[model samples]
Target chain A: MTVYEFAKGLILEAGGQVRSRMDESIQVETKSNPNDLVTNIDREVENYIYNSILDTYPDHQVIGEEGHGHELTQLEGFSWVIDPIDGTLNFVHQADNFAISIGIYKDNESYAGFVYDVISDTLYHAKKGEGAYINRQRIKTVEQTTLKTSIIGINPNWLTRSKSEAIFKQIVADARSARAYGSAALEIVNVATGKLAAYMTPRLSPWDYAGAAIILEEVNGVVTDLLGNPLSLIKPSSVIAANPQIHEEILTHYLSHHNEDISAFHQYLNSK
Target chain B: MTVYEFAKGLILEAGGQVRSRMDESIQVETKSNPNDLVTNIDREVENYIYNSILDTYPDHQVIGEEGHGHELTQLEGFSWVIDPIDGTLNFVHQADNFAISIGIYKDNESYAGFVYDVISDTLYHAKKGEGAYINRQRIKTVEQTTLKTSIIGINPNWLTRSKSEAIFKQIVADARSARAYGSAALEIVNVATGKLAAYMTPRLSPWDYAGAAIILEEVNGVVTDLLGNPLSLIKPSSVIAANPQIHEEILTHYLSHHNEDISAFHQYLNSK
Candidate 1:
């Protein structure tokens, strides 16, 4: 089967597994901190995706939020990036607002990606050349609107921290409104589907944004760091995925530091 | 039919009607201002709700967000308060995050209340003296949690406005995280179901919160204004709906003004 077809099948099956397990008493554990949680469902789902890919492809590499793949020094061949439950806290606590995200990249180029909002039964997917879609209908990114008329997604916790807090607070004040759904993939997909104009956060891992990043980009959205540079797939960094027009507007006006090009930071990822 | 029975039937029916129109192109119109929109669907839904209630009980009064009822000097008899689409913006834009909210009040007391999230098909309902429920399962308000560990629902727009900005920013900073769903009813129900520890917005009309307020109250939550007083059913005011334990905590610590009760403001309703 083609990688896209295989991925669609695996995601639907894993989503079914997640739905069925929602009612059962889940076994939960903490990682890193008390608030950060992982349920057995996450592990099971990640394993299912990992096994399904490896069983068929045999040579493809997989990187997962649950640590499913090898620790590699370089990206090579077909690489799968997945976050089994992007909002594990929402899943464990509210039984909703979480997503199963998977992105398949071949040799550093976007190939296929899918972000399934499990509870809502909504599927957002895209291929390299094919346009992004929510379920079956094709979607385009929202029109470029100024900060005063846009609805952006921003986590409230970001306000407390110092790094980007001051800058983000200004954006929040200038924007029409802000939202934080707790799931990065879902928020990014919301922007792709025109549910939100933009979504920004200070930190995120590859698995957290891989799937939605491609989908957003497919919809003519700009996926970049806070300073309007392409995001690095190997490491976590600040992210601002917005429509093409607002991407530069926000970067030059809202996110820029003294009119300096922030491309210097991205050199680290290329050197890796 | 019993009031509760009649309400349940109409809510589901209205919800179905709303669902059917989801795909059809909707004509939007502005109400008080540019940001405040009243779609053809809102008027249609409000009219349907008004006609349904009045048709059943001529003696009963109906007040709607779309301005269906009369301005009365006295609180008397059975009254139904409704917001056809609680999150109109979400309904018009996202088509998933909005809900239908209805509250039944009698002789100044909260009676039967319902907030149905149409897209998710989740029903949150409650009747006075019985219990609050989500669909069929009985729901209890969330347990007491400190601000440091709580997840709050606050509109980012509120952060930009000055009246409550300083205090709300502190709450946002103190809380573990913040979420802005853009729907008052959904956020209030989220608090009732423990998905959110508290939900606060400085100004919302009666129809915006009437129904969810009853549900939250029945679930052992405290539904009040910013001043820690029971919200006036007649006028717009700052709202803070929280668990019983933290209601006073938030009002006193996060939303208080010089340790004085703001009940004096309610006199305006009496004077009217």
Candidate 2:
């Protein structure tokens, strides 16, 4: 099978494993800190994907959030980076909001990515040079919807910490709506699905943005640093990914309010 | 059937009706302001409950968010106050987070209530002096949990406006986690399910808190004004509802930061 086919098969299989496990009471463990968590379901799901992929493609490398997989230096050749459950805290609390995210890289470049919001049964997938897909139908980033007409997904952390609040307040003032779903991976899926016109976050880790980055870009959406530059897949950065029109408008009007912070945000991106 | 069963059945049936209609495109109209919205599905759902109940109990009074039902006064005899879509913003944006909530009262006292989060398939139900249930299984309110070990659901507005960010900051400084789901109805449901230790919000109307109020109380949780007095079914107020111990700690420490606002809030509640 082609890598995409193998990836999709594994994702669906892992998703089913996840679905069945939700009803079973499983022990939850704190990861990194109390705010972050991982359950046996996460490891079980990740192991299923890892074993399936390794048996199918032994040469391919892997990185998974559960620490059940490798720690990679370079993203050379075929490498699969997985986050078995992307909103783990939400999953621990609500048994929702968590996503099974997988991104495939060939020769250090993203080839395909899949993010399945398992509970909602929505799968957002994309292959580079082709297009994005939500379920089966091919999808693209929505057209240049104006800021005032846009509904954006944001993380509440930025509302207080990052100087982005001015931009955020302006975005809220300009957009149809503003929301924070607490999951970067899922938010990117929403952006790709056209359910969200744009998504911005001041800081995200490489693990948080990798899967969704491939999907968002494949759909013709722009994913860039706060200063309006493309995101580096190998590293995390402050980002504004949106419909082309609003992305630029947001970059122009919203970024100007915090020109100093904008420059500093860019500097932080570069340092990362 | 008892009033509680009647209310639960109607609420679930109304929810199913709303969910079935969700796939079909419908005209959405702005309500109150652009930030708020109402769809034909909302009115249809509320109307279904209203007509179905009136058919059996013609003398019963009904109040609904859509304004399609009666303007309840004095709450004499049986009354059903409902919010067809508790989180219209979520419904409009995410097609989820919206819930069907119905609050039943007998002789000016809340008797039965149900809040069904259609998408999540979570049904939080309660009956006066009986208890609360989740998916028909009894669920008691969470026992006394320290703020340091608790998770809280807060309204974003309060974080930005509440004069004392102490409780907010303290909770962040102390709690296991903090979140804001943007739906008062769902937040209360979270408390009933023990997913959250407490829910605090300022400026809520009767329609928003009615169903949740009944559910939280049934679970052995306490719902009170910021001053630790019982919340009124009639007046809108700033609320801090939690497991008893946490509720007292939150009120004494966190809520006291805004002493000046308390009296004004009291006045507002009394005036309403």
Candidate 3:
């Protein structure tokens, strides 16, 4: 099978395996701090995908959350960054909401991105230079939607972090409403589908965004840093993903009202 | 058919109707404040359910979100409290994470409850004594879970609300981790299935808690006012719903830590 077909078949197969074991007992462990959880299932699922892909393409590079894959200096040819379970806490505790994420980059360009919301059996996929799709239907972000006409997704954690607080509060106070769905990738997908006008998460990792970043861009949506600069696929930044028209509106309002402390926090993170 | 059977049928039909319209062009509106949203779809779904139930059981009382039915007083006799789309904001924005909530109470005792997550096609239901089920198999709260093994769900708004700051901070310090899902009924259902250790929301309306409150109780879970008192079915409260063991830990460690202003807020609401 070709690489794309092989990845698709393997992802669905791995997802099916997970569904069968949904009701079985699990061993949950903490990561980083107490609030972050990792389950044995996450590791096993990642391993299954990793081994399957490696068997198909022996020379390809992989960066996986389970730590079982190779790490390289730069993205050269074919590289896959996999988040076997994107919402691990949602998986270990609720047995749902977690998803399997896989993205393929060819020669430092996002080639294909796939996010399978396992429990719901919904697959959101995109190929570079092609339109985004859910089950093969074309998707596009909504246009000309004002803040009052839009529903924005935000991270609740951003509400308290000093750097994100003032701007975040102003956006919430200005928008028709704001919601936090707990999954950065999924929320961006919502924006691409026009289900949400925009999505902003102040803290995200590359794996958390790799898939949705490509999908949103394919649908004519924009993703940027908080200061209205372009987002790089190499690292995570304070993300603002929205339709192009409202992109500047969000950033302009955010910067106009940002306080000194908020700017200081951003400076601190940039230094790191 | 028995009352239980009839209610189940109604719930399934209404759920299917809501699902079929998921992708239709929608007209959205804001409610009460810019931070809250109401949709034409929300009103349509509630009206559809309200009319269907009233047409079938003309004598039954109905309390619905759109104010389509009578003004709610006490939960007397055969009353059906419905939140046609419990997470209107999620539905309007994410097109997911929302559900059809229905609660059947006979003279103040919960008789049957259904929270159908239309997108996932998962129906979390209980008949007071028949035990809780997710797609017909019996389910229980996470077994042997403690605060350290738990992830609590709280609204981000609580962090900024003056009265909730201390308790909110204490919860952040206490739980292994925390999240804000933006749906009260769904969050309560998460507690029923052990997806979350606890779900704390400072303010809720009866329509928001009616359905999941019943299911949570059937799974050996507890939903009480922040002081650990039983919830009043007719009025919303500062709620903490959890597995019995973890419930007390949250009450003592987090809820109790809030000073007089928060307690007064709770008491002031209860008196109303």
Candidate 4:
């Protein structure tokens, strides 16, 4: 089977496994901080995907959220970036809105990507040089719209705690409306599908956005750090994924004026 | 038929009509402000529901989001409150996450309430003395969870613009996480279903919380203005809907410390 086919099949199977496991009591734990949650299902799903990839393509490397493939950092050859459960807090609390995301890379270039909304049975996937699809139905590119006519997704915490808090607060006021779904993958998918004009965050890891970056790019959406720089596939960075128009507008009008604040934030992120 | 049965049937049918009309080109307009959006579908659905209610119970009064029943002031007899499309911006842009909300009242008391999620076809409804349901499945009362272990939903705008910004900022920081779904009705439903520990806003119309208040109360959830006062059935007010434990804790610990800020905000809302 082609690499895309194998990845798609594995993600679907993993989603099914997650759905079945939801009925049983979930064991929860925290990492990094008290609010950052992880569940037994997340580790189990990651392990299953990691083993399955090694068994099928022994030469391919894997990097996952649960640290199964953390040692293999460089995307030198064929590598898979996986977030077994993209929204662990949502998964544990709401039992909905979480997703399993996977991105396949060849020599640091995106090859294929998939984000499976397990509860909704919706799969958003794309391959290099090809268009994106939601459950096998092709999705249209985001229509051109301005900030005043758009709906953006942003976490409320950023508006309160980020170094560029004032800048983000202005952006929230300027936009037509704002929503926070608490899932980066789903918010990025919403941008690709034209549901949200933009989705921004102060920081996101590779596994949090790798799959979504591929799908968004396929549909003419732009994914970049807050400084308008391309995101690193090997490290966490501040992210802003939006349609082409809003992306440029925000970078120019909003983010450009506050370089000092944004730089400070990025420097803080790097220090961490 | 009983008021609950008739209201549920009409809401389901209205949801069907709204879904069918989504395929057509929508006419958009703003009410009160540029960000406040309304669409042709909203008017059509409200009109349908208003006419259907009057045709069935001519003596019953109706109050709708659109101006269909705005003149009706006193809820001395049987009354119906309707928000044909609760999340107009979502309906216009994302085409999902919006809902149809209706609450039936008799002499200022809740008789029945229904909030239909059109895209998913899930109906959350409740009668005064009856327990709440989701598409006929009985939902449990909100589970006991602390602020540090709970997920609450609050519009980010409140954190930026309200008089209680600093207080709300603290509340958000103290919570495990915060989410904003952009629809008051759906957010309140999330509180009732225990998907969200609490949902609060600076101000919301009676139509916004009328339906959700009944559903939440049926599930042993508390619905009140931010100051812990009961919501009026004929006017707008600040809202905080939560499980019993969180409700008491938040009011006692957080909001009570800053009554001046909250009251000033409420006064501004009343002035508007």
Candidate 5:
């Protein structure tokens, strides 16, 4: 079987575990702060994904949110960027709105990505040179979507005192409506599937968007930093995932006007 | 069976139809504008609920979002306030995040309320005297929650030059996070179930928060206008649903501080 199919199976399995075990007791813990939460399921899920990767492809390397494998300073050959529980707080508190995100990088390039919204039983996957699909249906790029009539995913916390606070607030005011599901992977997949026109977060790690980046790219969706910079799978940064039309509108009109605070913008964008 | 039990079954069945028939093609139409949407499913579901109420309790009065039954200028005995589909846009686009919200009133008082999130198959319900429940588990009133550590449901659209703009922005900033789920029923239900500390919209119709109001009140959760005034069952007004602890804090601290703009706030709060 192709590595992509194997990854898909692994994602579905992990998602099944999450869905089945959600209502049971989970030990919640804090990572960076009170808002940043982790649970035992997160670590266990990471371990499960890591073990499967190692057992199936012994040479493949794994980078995870929890320490489950050798930490790679750089993205080398056949590395998997995995977030066992992308929205751990949501998993712990709400028992929903979380996903298992896996991005397989081959030779330092995007090869395949899978973001499984566990509770909804939706699997979004894509392989390099192929196209993205939500379940079995091939996804299509959005055309001529205007920002004024678009529904965007925005974390409202960024509206206060961030370097892009003004810019972000303007976007929120201009956009049709902004929603925050508190899950980056699902929000990115929302754009890929045309459910949301765009989604932006001021701070997201490599594991959060790596898998979604590939899937969205395959669907002709745009994934980049909030300032329209290319994303790095080895570094954490702000991500703005959108279809082609809205992506161009946001990048050109709202994001490009803020040249004065480029340094502060980069700091806040990469801080998380 | 009690009217409350009868309402519960009716809601679950209505919710079942919404869940099962979600994928089918439905004609979409604009209400006030393009952003305000309604579908054939919305009318069909409203008709189903109205017919069920009429057949079971012909003496009862009903007020629905769609023109389904006799319009009530005043709330009398055994009245049901139903929004056939809350978050119709979410239903049409995302196929999730929408719900069937029913508020049962008797003699001008909230008797029972039910909000069923269709895709998730989760039911939140409460009677006036009894406590609130999610599915079958009784939800408790949250204690000692603070704004600094609380998650709030806030619509960013109010950040424009409205009277409450400054107060709303401060609340968004002071709170740990602000979320906009685009469904008032689910947002209020989120507060009732302790999933969120507080949720408010500048304007909501009677049908939007009627059912949720009963549920919140049952758990000793607070439901009020932005200025802490009691909500009216016969008119559109601002709705703030919150846990027991932070409700006082938000009302006393942020919402009440804007006494200077009370008239303007009143005008904006009920404009929708």
Candidate 6:
């Protein structure tokens, strides 16, 4: 089987396990803060993916959110980044709106990506040159949309506490509407499918966005850091994913004015 | 058939029509503001529901968001309140998060309620004394949860523009997480199903919350205006729906401190 097919199989299998075991009681622990949650299922899923990768491609290196995989300082040959459960708090609380994400890279370039929405039975996947698909249907490029007529996904907390709160608050006011689904992977795919014009956050780990970024890119959507820079494969950074027009509009009209505050915020995140 | 059964049938039929017609090109128009939207499908669904109700119960009065029904000064006799498409913007854009909502009232008392998530094919329904159900399974009463550990659903725009922005912002910070699904009926049912501990908004029309209120109450949840006042069946009002403990806590600890501001906001809404 091709590497892309194998990755898809692994994600589907992991998603199946999550769907079946969700009814049983789960053990949850706090990570960075009380609200930052992780569950036993997350660790188990990560372990299964990691072991499966090693058994198939013994030389492949894996990095996952639950620490069951290698911690690489840099992307090397045949590297995989995975998030076992992208929205752990949603998984533990709502029992839905979470996904298992897998991104395969050769050296530093994206090769394939998969994001499986466990509850909904929807799988979003893409190969480097091939286009994106939801389940079996190929997704079309996001239609051109304006900021005033588009729905955007953003965490409400950013408006209340982030250094760029003023700028974000203005965007929220100007947009058609705003939603916070609490899953970066799903939100990115939402943009890919034209369900949202844009999805942005001030800080997200690579595993949180890695897999879905490939899917979004396949649909002609743009993914970049808040400062309009290419995302770093190894570091947590602010992210904004949108169709070309809306992306350019936000970066040029709104985010450009808050460069210093955004820079300081990025510095604070990196220091932490 | 009982009134509850008839209402459910009407909702399901309307939802089915919505699901089938979703792929067709639609005509959208702005309502109170540019962001406040309505569509031809919304009008079509409302007309279908109103005619269906009148055909079955000739004496029943109807009030709906799309204005196919009566505008009573006070709800009298067998009155039906409905929002044919609850999240019009979601219906227009995402085509997924929106729902069809219907509430049957005997004078001012809630008799039955239904909120049908068209895309997911999930139906949330309840009779006044009967417990709530999603599709076929009966839902349990919301578990006891502290505000610090609970997720909430709220419009982010409220944080930017409402009179109680400070209080709402503080509550958002204290919660586990916050989401905005852009549908009041679904958000209220999110509380009913224990997916959200609470959902609050500064202003909403009667059609928005009418149906979901009964479902929530049947699950031992609380529904009240922002000032802890009983919601009017004939007018727009601020709304807060939550499980009992969180509802009481939010009112006593957070909202109580800002009565004048909230009251003034209510007055402003009333004047408008």
* Candidate closer to the true structure by TM-score (higher is better), 1 or 4: 4
lDDT against true structure, model 1: 0.83
lDDT of 6 by residue, B1-272 (tens): 89888888889988899888978999999999999999999999999999998888899889999875544788788999999899999989998899999888997788999999999999999999988999999999987687999999987877777565776988887888999999999999999988899999988988999999999999889999989998987878999999989999889999999888888888898898
Q: Candidates' lDDT values, in order?
A: 0.83, 0.76, 0.77, 0.90, 0.83, 0.90
Off by over 4 Å in 2: A18-34, A38-48, A66-74, A119-122, A129-131, A136-151, A162-177, A262-272, B23-25, B68-73, B119-122, B155-176, B265-272
Worst 10 residues of 4 chain B by lDDT: B158-167
Candidate 6 chain B has its poorest 10 consecutive residues by lDDT at B158-167
iRMS value of model 2? 3.8
Task: Rate residue A267 of model 3 by lDDT.
Answer: 60
> How would you encode candidate 2's per-residue C-alpha lDDT over A1-272 as one tens digit per residue?
78998888788888877888788887888766766777888888888888888888889888887774444667778988888888887787767777888988899887999998898788888888888888898885566688765677764444454356555655655676665566789888778767778988787656677788899888777788777776654555787878788888888887756767777766776684
Q: Model 4 over residues A111-209: C-alpha lDDT tens digits?
A: 998999999999999998899999989988878789999999998887677575766988887888889998899999999999999999988989999
lDDT measured at residue B101 in model 4 versus the true structure, 0 to 100: 97
Least accurate stretch of 10 residues (summed lDDT) in model 2 chain B? Answer: B157-166
Give the per-residue lDDT digits (tens) of candidate 4, residues B57-105: 9999999989866776678789888999998889999889999999889
The residue pairs found clashing in candidate 1 are none
The parts of candidate 3 lying over 4 Å away from their true place are A21-31, A68-71, A142-144, A147-149, A160-167, A229-236, A255-272, B22-31, B35-59, B68-72, B141-144, B263-272
- Interface root-mean-square deviation (Å) of every model: 2.0, 3.8, 3.2, 1.1, 1.8, 0.9
**Could you give the DockQ of candidate 5?**
0.54
DockQ ranking from best to worst?
Answer: 6, 4, 1, 5, 3, 2
The candidate with the higher TM-score, 3 or 4, is 4
What pairs collide in candidate 6? none
Tens digits of per-residue lDDT, candidate 2, B5-106, equal 777777878778777777899778986667678888888888888899999999988888777444444677898888888888778766877788888889
TM-score of chain B of each: 0.93, 0.90, 0.93, 0.97, 0.93, 0.97
Q: What is the TM-score of chain A alone in each candidate?
A: 0.93, 0.87, 0.90, 0.98, 0.93, 0.98
Q: Is the docking of candidate 3 incorrect, acceptable, medium or high quality?
A: acceptable
Could you give candidate 6's per-residue lDDT for residues A1-272 as a string of tens digits?
98998999889999999999978999999999999988899999999999999999999988898884445788889989999999998899999999999988998999998999999999999998899999999999889899999999998877778565776888888898999898999999999999999999989888988999999999899999989999977778999999999999999999999888788888898898
Candidate number with the higher DockQ (1 or 6): 6
- Give Cα distance to truth, residue B243, candidate 1, Å: 2.0
Per-candidate DockQ versus the true complex? 0.55, 0.25, 0.39, 0.76, 0.54, 0.80
Candidate 5's residue-wise lDDT over B95-148, tens digit each? Answer: 888989999988987799999999989999988888889999988865457898
